[model samples]
Target: MRTPADFCADKDALLVPAVRIVVRIVGVEQQKQGDAHVLGATEPELKCGPGVDNDGYFDADTPLGPYYLAPDAAIRLLTYDEKAQRMGLTDPVPVATLRDVLKACKSGKQPGTPYTCSGGFFHAAMDTKGVITELTEIFQS
Candidate 1:
């Protein structure tokens, strides 16, 4: 278990910040830990600092990026196209695409094929704990 001092030290390390990435979750599942959620995606994760750049898979060993979201993590569900427009993204992944994929995953159905779509991303600490401190989901007006 992490002691108070250990937690505090982790918090302090965030001041310098490590890395934040935008991950499009194609699937989600409750982890055995019960306190965390596992997210899977087909596309490479993108770094969300300074500029969006390729960050590779959350699991470098595998082609699919499977990441864990902390129990207290914040989650935001919003319209991807709208968020993309606001971000001045010329090409935006439609929310419907991600929705369908997630739906299939939840229903124990494999997606017909892999495709790229936009939903939201979480800022993770360098610790690899995959804790999301805050998240804001912006929807269409």
Candidate 2:
């Protein structure tokens, strides 16, 4: 239920203009370990403001921090990474390290997206490193 005005949180300190990026982070137990899931599960989320300081996650210019997009929101995938480099999209361009990717995928089982009165659904199990590496070839080809 976060209105557009609500998403106006500050990015860390990248000193870039405010660029909007809808971010999704997977947690271990469906529930965030600490302040992780501040934006609830199912509903679309407003920008939560700056992310944890370069915690091996998305590499955005701290200023235009990443925000949560409510789970129910139908977001189209943006392929502007190559186009939006200076604007602050390419930061996440680097492939997640094998360790970080593994840990993040493990967090997926927790199903961070919020649900209605019923609660939530678990989108556990995403592609593993082996799978991703194999899939990466498609992009290479």
Candidate 3:
């Protein structure tokens, strides 16, 4: 199993193009009703490269890969009810409520803990300097 330590070991090594990285969530601080003010997580890992479909939603033959991480500040949080109807959950759940859900995910006290309502996968567009210029959420789960 890959751990945060693995990702932190060589942050530069994981930046190769077509390589997908998976980051683990450490904490979340919701700013607005739906916007994640600050989403903290561990570094990323070289989870997989091109041609592998980690999530079934993508076409197996597609070249694009998603980098999984704690949703950045750009992400909008959705409520339990809103998330259930995945067509588009625009309404933001309260930060306190989201904290409860995140706590449950971490504590494993509730069924279906470690929930996706708090995180998402992004299709990151990096610049020549390897800086992420744009991160579009391809999937929220």
Candidate 4:
């Protein structure tokens, strides 16, 4: 298996489902502002996963390949698309409740992580457990 300490640098690390679950859970209680906020493990940005604002870190092992620490100001679902553009969905709606978001990430089907690439499109089913597992591997060891 791959550990977080095994990671290197200058590479695109993919976020896993399990990792997302853990971070999302811990992030909720963490700070929710500034760079250090998301990576603090108490910010809600944990749900941001690995791409946006990339704000999460881990000191683990990963002989599989290299990886870069996300950051500390990652964004979340509701924070991503403020104008829902998927599935005929128009207006901004905070559909993800704290309880459900946690349950889904743990269930292995997160379904969304918040992305406003288009400023109006909302893509669901964006799980991050994969990356979560990678960054959080050391804690287990």
Local distance difference test scores for all models: 0.39, 0.23, 0.38, 0.27
What lDDT tens digits, residue by residue, belong to model 4 across residues 15-134? 333333223222222235532212223211122235623233342222321211233222233323436643222233322333244445445663355421111111112225222112
- lDDT, candidate 3, equals 0.38
Better of 1 and 3 by lDDT: 1
Q: On TM-score, who's better, 2 or 4?
A: 4
Structural similarity to truth (TM-score) of each candidate: 0.39, 0.18, 0.34, 0.20
TM-score of 4: 0.20
In TM-score terms, candidate 1 sits at 0.39
* Clash pairs (backbone) in predicted model 3: 105-114
Q: Choose the strongest candidate by TM-score.
A: 1
Total clashes in model 3, counting residue pairs 3 or more apart in sequence or in different chains: 1
Error of 3 at 136 (Å): 9.2
TM-score, predicted candidate 2 vs. hidden true structure: 0.18
C-alpha RMSD in Å of predicted model 4 compared with the true structure = 14.9
- Writing each residue's lDDT as its tens digit, candidate 1 over 12-130 gives 44323334443445566777765566667433322232332231212222334666555555443333234344332222333344446557645666544332222333233333454
Which residues of candidate 1, in runs, are more than 4 Å off?
1-18, 42-64, 79-101, 104-128, 134-141
6-90: candidate 2 lDDT, tens digit per residue: 2343333221222322223331122244322122222123323455332212222222212232222222111213343311111
Q: How many Å off is the CA of 113 in candidate 4?
A: 11
| Candidate closer to the true structure by TM-score (higher is better), 3 or 4 | 3
Ranking by lDDT: 1, 3, 4, 2
User: Which candidate number would show the highest lDDT if scored against the true structure?
Assistant: 1
